[model samples]
Target: MKKNIFKIFAALFFIAVIVSCRKEDPLNVDFSKLNIDNPVANTPLDTWLTTTFLNEYNIDVIYRYNRFYHGDDRDVAAVKVDKVQPQMQTVLEGFLLPYRKVAGVTFIKKYAPKQFVLFGSGSYNPDNSYTLATAAAGRNITIYDLNSFDLSDPNTIVNKLRTIHHEFTHILNQIVPMPVDFQLITKSTYLATWTTKSDESAQADGYVTPYASSQPGEDFAETTTSLLVYGQAWYDDRANGSTAAGKIALKAKEASVEQYFTVNLGIDFRALQREIQEVVRNTYNYQQASFPYWLGQNLYKSLIVNAAGDPIYSAFPLSTPFSLVNNNMKTAIAALPYGLTYNFMKLNFTSSTAMDIEINFNQGTRSFISRYAYTMDLDQATGQTKFTIAAVGGNDASWVGNANLLRPAVQPMLDYLSNNTFVADWLPTGVDAVNYNKYGGFYVLGTPANNFYGLLGQ
Candidate 1:
């Protein structure tokens, strides 16, 4: 009996030793229960944020069991764990979660945000900055890497909400697209050495800022951010202030953005922009002062005039009774603003089969600037033609002030007239249409109205 008892004890001791030898989960650590005075037991996190904080955007949370700790000396390292909510959720709610819920919302999601990684401070990457949200193609966002997750950042709107908003902007534009013509406005003169130049010099060139001239993708994201975050007035002010180039750059961006959302397909870009600013006000728990809101209101007004009665386009020949006539051309002499201006184009039709458009952009103000023309031909087969807009260099608004950062991009649009083009027509001849498409540095020139004598279908 004594020998048997000894054997059993030895077996138990071996089992204990084996269990103690298991490896630690590098990304998992449990902080002591968050003794927040009674977070309701078993209540889902989404329910908590909604019932307690009043958000209407759908909330999905995956808990991460992790811990993180910080100090200059790295002496107080604590394990960290947290959860990830959707990046889209924050963006939707940034202004109108409730309205979206009623409307059955839309957002660009090539892939859903990743699993909320739960781990302790041990999982923190020494090389990573304060990342409240992150995504891998196959994995979910790993929250709780509490480096810059500060509640006290007075200058930053850097909570989980703003972080998600910023990241989602990246994800959406990645999937959808911005106008190609925006790049044509300033083409190749974009600079890396812009910081060395003053804002005035940069403006003379056509960039909104040295920073904005960085890249095509950056321009799209920043443009989206500006409209969605600051609203149109803010965008207008950035263009109008400081330098001639900045203003010019901004105007092109504004027009392209309007064209993209209104001409292309998406949310009412101008209206949604207003809604986004309103979201910033509501979610962060502050009402915008009248001054800022009007700035936004006025900014939108610049893009579209007040429509108290019937729209003038209602009278166009496409919708109204009319016939082909060459005697009428809309032309007027006026000083172009710091932004965009248009001179009428003439497409001369020869016989019943051939036609071509003669295009010339504005001459510069004060001292005469250089002039250039882009030519395009109408197609008989596929109904396609090609043309290029300038990429850089137009003093049309150069005297008004331009953002040097954006000029390189803006100048390309002017230069595109000099570039080659390949155009596509969805509607064939005779069915009058004023279609517009923006290639990177030029506006495409193919219209149903080009060969207006008779419909191709006729």
Candidate 2:
């Protein structure tokens, strides 16, 4: 009925147009009144977007502000022409490439959002909050506050990427449902007035952030995306800061997210995490994403140096000061009256302020362990740790007999550790991502070539 009514109205309009046209001759009609210029003419940005996004992935980038793209009530600004490319460059490197590396090019091309809409200013809310990003129908992602973007600021890059990943996670959930087990992990704690809650408070209740407490869907997205952008170190810091129950809940959610990506999506989340962290470290140069940063956070409890056996120590060229000391200790211990061979040394970081230099040795079938305690002054900001030997000792008979007997032999290694301040860092540059966490060591602050690295363990 509506279609027939529209057709009748159209016929009446056509008759009126014919009568009007008869009143004026065809040549007399004015053509200059019509506007003929293309409003959507291709700019350089358009051409780049076409080749980079549209041509490669069938994605459309709409930076020209159209009021219809946003809500009627909200007043948003158009994206600055210059800021568009840099913002999208981050999207390409930080978001798209990580997934491409881990999940494969085809997976992202299949599941990635079809359109991106950029806005200069934020999409403000009546509640005094603003939207950073939003996704619709698994097809469109709109990012706001592009005018304030700073490519050089790691936090700015991370914040934008986090929101993008968060929205993308929502898109993925729409395609493949999030695990029901994730929802049940913190079911009773969710709040409708989540805005009133602080992130600290929400984290104590097992939510990754305050927004996550709003719903189970947001919880899953926050947990997944936070890990992806902030890296595992940030997640570990949050988990460690939570209450006992909250820690358990967060860990459970992490496991669920791992399972979701690994089992449901056929993506290795850890491998994806490594790829993303590499970008965070190398591309963004985020200090918190580095291994040394986590070491200071006490994420890894111990670092073992077995120079005589492990080849990685040498591969990282840990041979200079550390290998020299390792071989000397072996020689000195071998020269003892009885048959004794040197074993690996372990630096047990008992706490942020304390560590134990545990020296191990073998005589025939028996292994003797001696421990010397030291207080550490760690400047986490500078990645430097200063060690000072404790005046007292609770040394057992083994330490008294073996350590005292071998003190002159091991004093050189002891002085090497205690005499100078060292900068802690991951030693292997350009090594495989799998081996990143496998080795970390310290270089003497003033003398970098005098450094030693070892296998790390929790």
Candidate 3:
């Protein structure tokens, strides 16, 4: 009985050993039957992006909406199909190309972010603040708010380019860290909640912007980006306007940034700035043939006469029935008696120094237009703006009577024109239909109490 039990136990142990040593057959599956979806298809935009970004610089542009591109926690929308190209074109022209030209193609290829991800709407925060663009690990960049991009609008163009410059600055700093002294300059001013601070307040505290006051890294990025994007004039203006300590701090920061680029990157910071400024100027050339807001709309002229019934200076015409003719040009068409419709006054910018002001009249019998050409001079030394009538009627003798009637009204314009130095002081307040407010006309520069004419659009 003992021998039989030993043999049975030995057989059980042998069976267990065989089972453990035995190998299982590999699982067989057919990849042919498996369904696979290609997320990124070869479309025209894809080919263009591949050619423009990927092929050139090994950078990938992901315009198609993917939640994974944005973090899972962030709720952002995809960029509209149509807005993608214009916005990208503006960015390439205004931001990247400038850097490529100044910093060199090799420098950008080496330092530029490897991937750019686009979104249509801004990334909204719990505090109601929206993010325009951001970069991660110095490799991926995400730009938001493509839906409202307008290539023609200077403000929009500047703003979007500003974001790109700001983020790119971060990427640059990642490669070569900012000077340690930069943080010490505004060490006490750094705040986590920078949104509460206004730009003016931040400037007073030795920061370029409120966001710059958040941290030293952000401060460096803001200063560099602002200098490059807004140009030296804008930087100087801001620095000049700041408080004494703020000015010192700004200059110190500026010196540090300039040194970093020069020493580390072998780049002339000012030359880079000029290159960027030229690109921006070409993109949004303010000198293009476009009318100022005050010109194309109906203006109410107020005439002021002395007690002796002599016209001292007539304010702009009081509710003139004239309508702008050739909206693109400075000619106005007014309805007159005897079925006569004529350009009341055509203001022409003939040359840099000359402006031709033409006045016309029907007079019930015959109609004639008189041209009063003026040669303007701006006194750069005294900062005084002046304009004077160099010639009257432009050799036309037909409407001297109409020119006489229009002289009083046009004189204030000439006087206002004489103070052309004030043109720089005019700020854009807002827009009303096709007309813009606070650019020109009477309401801008100073109060109506100072000037006789008010540019009101009806």
**In model 3, which runs have C-alpha deviations exceeding 4 angstroms?**
1-41, 286-458
lDDT of 3 by residue, 11-114 (tens): 99999999989999977975435622224457677787788888987888888788998788788988887787777776678777777877898898888899
lDDT of 1: 0.40
Q: Write the per-residue lDDT of candidate 1 for residues 152-260, one digit (tens) a residue.
A: 3312342444344445445544555667898777777666544465656655555544545656655555565665565444555566663566567777877886677
lDDT of each: 0.40, 0.85, 0.64
Clashes of each: 85, 0, 6
Q: What shift in Å separates residue 5 of candidate 3 from its native position after superposition? A: 51
TM for every model, in the order presented, reads 0.42, 0.82, 0.57
Best by lDDT: 2
The pairs that clash in candidate 2 are none
TM-score quality measure for candidate 1: 0.42
Indicate the residue-level lDDT of 334 in model 1. Answer: 23
How well is each residue in 59-80 modelled by candidate 2, as lDDT tens digits? Answer: 9998887899998999999888
Candidate 3 lDDT score relative to the true structure: 0.64
